[model samples]
Target: MGVSLRDVADLAGVSVKTVSNVVNGYAHVAPATRAKVEEALSRLDYRPNLSARNLRRGRTGVIALALPELDAPYFAELSRFVIDAAAEQRWLVVIEQTDGSLERERQILDGVRDHRVDGLILSPIAIGADELAARTDETALVLLGERIHDGPADHVAIDNVRAARDVTEHLIGLGRTRVAALGAQDSAVSGTAPLRLAGYREALAAHGLPETVVRVERYRRADGAAAMAGLLTGGDRPDAVFCFNDLLALGALRAILSRGLRVPEDIALAGLDDIEDGRYSTPTLTTVAPDKAELARIAVDLLRRRIDGRSGHAPQEVRAGYRLMARESTLGR
Candidate 1:
């Protein structure tokens, strides 16, 4: 009844395929063809039928972004970036949480065949390289964070080990020997936690310091608070603490303040992933800044390319470097 894609294509003097490409936001379409199609659509009042488009393209025009927790400011900001990137290409984002569980990761992977989304950008928890290699055949999977294995799929991440080493070195340079490592873990698959922890240990080794006082946890703000509280009361009190993330660092900040201790003056604190809230926090968080927007841009582009059958470009392992932003939290005013 209403204006159709056919009408727009016919009016534009282009093949239906060309019109489809234009509507789908394909990057390869010429500007002239796109302009003509757009003009014809506007003239005919032709609206896109998303359902029909999905059927034609055999794609849902949706991508899944599986993250750990949206409550964390970093994940929240990361989700926003991914959503914006996908939206520019006329794609939708479906967010999921793994709760840092292996079973949940498996379930998310199994869901790819259901047509909920054409691809996935995963911040997998406890997922191994073998599992990803087996599951990524049907859907385009872009792995994010240190949890992902260096296997198949395009990866977007920062060099966590180097970043952590730099953070530790910075603390060391400040003459803080009794440095406490917060959020340490024995192992993590598909994320930067393990790598960063390894770097922390490496930094300690480099400085000829003991790596005995690591506070392992699930990397939550509460966990940071609890870990810091334990360290404060325990016999081995750290002169400085390096948390795995800003949320944890914030928690530690609260714990340190409650003890009537001055930040940096009593115990210096630092963290990674310089989230938005970190900048505004009292004694603003000192953290490793990753270019989240750029990471999102690359991830969206990579998934789009994979879905479009552009496999000539090999799997890209883009590691965005981190910058140590010294703030009030680490440097006593």
Candidate 2:
């Protein structure tokens, strides 16, 4: 008969479940709502049930890192950095792959996660901010990449538009005209593709150069190979290609070689996410090098702070540093 959760919920003008989310440090709850709940809890002197407090104290001490696809070299490389970073704090990591499916992402967000992990570092691909905002379940989440939603979660990402624009400018600096943007995601409104495409368009406008575009269902090596093949057979082929990622750039490199063309001599090539394979290819790739190690370090540190029970702090939005690596692939051997 003491102050129950229902009383706190009523006082905060939210549901009991929402009050629970606020107390449990869920990510999706609005700042105002969480603040109101905290104020109500203070006024009512609310304390969690003994059993709940004991359960929270018995944390598994592990955390989950979920990405769209681990098969992608960039993600695989990032996993390496994250694992190493987590080891610094003596915490284990659980990796989850969503296979680039919105349904799967929604399922993960549904709170069916392994209770052992204290929190999550998620890189959502198929879901956007609007869809995430509509969800009621809350998790301690730190989002990575260009977030589609503006939720109360920490975000770690690089400036995609600026990176892409710089790549395009590099191509322009190489005296290459008729540059085509390869690996565009078709039938999609969000993701790396849209932002990079925006940069490509921006660079074209700034330099007064016409843009060449090819749309694909997804960003993959196979997608890049196929798109490059089609462009080889079509009219007004490009002299340079700025792919959305390293996988696509490598795929296109193979296609160009098989078609009896030498890279840089025939078409300059560039990509993002300085994956290792791209560095040692026959003609090394030029790319926007996002500091993956720094990204992992910063994100893991943020998660650690939350794990240490730091509360009443606004979520942070951090941008990782990146530099354009002008390699032999684009600069000529």
| Best candidate (score: TM-score) | 1
lDDT score, candidate 2, position 315: 76
Q: TM per model?
A: 0.86, 0.80
Candidate 1: 10-residue stretch with minimal lDDT: 144-153
lDDT of 2 by residue, 55-169 (tens): 8576666778889889888899899999999999977898989987888888777753446567788888888777766766445677777645355677888989899999999
Name the best candidate (by lDDT).
2
Query: Could you tell me the C-alpha RMSD of candidate 2 in Å?
Result: 12.2
Q: Per-residue lDDT for 3 in model 1?
A: 77
Which pairs of residues collide in candidate 1? 146-190, 146-191, 146-192, 147-189, 147-190, 147-191, 148-190, 148-191
Q: Listing every candidate in turn, what is its Cα RMSD in Å to the true structure after a full C-alpha superposition?
A: 4.3, 12.2
State residue 283's C-alpha deviation in candidate 1, in Å.
Answer: 1.3
Those runs of model 2 whose alpha carbons end farther than 4 Å from true positions after fitting are 1-58, 112-114, 310-313
| lDDT of each candidate versus the true structure | 0.83, 0.85
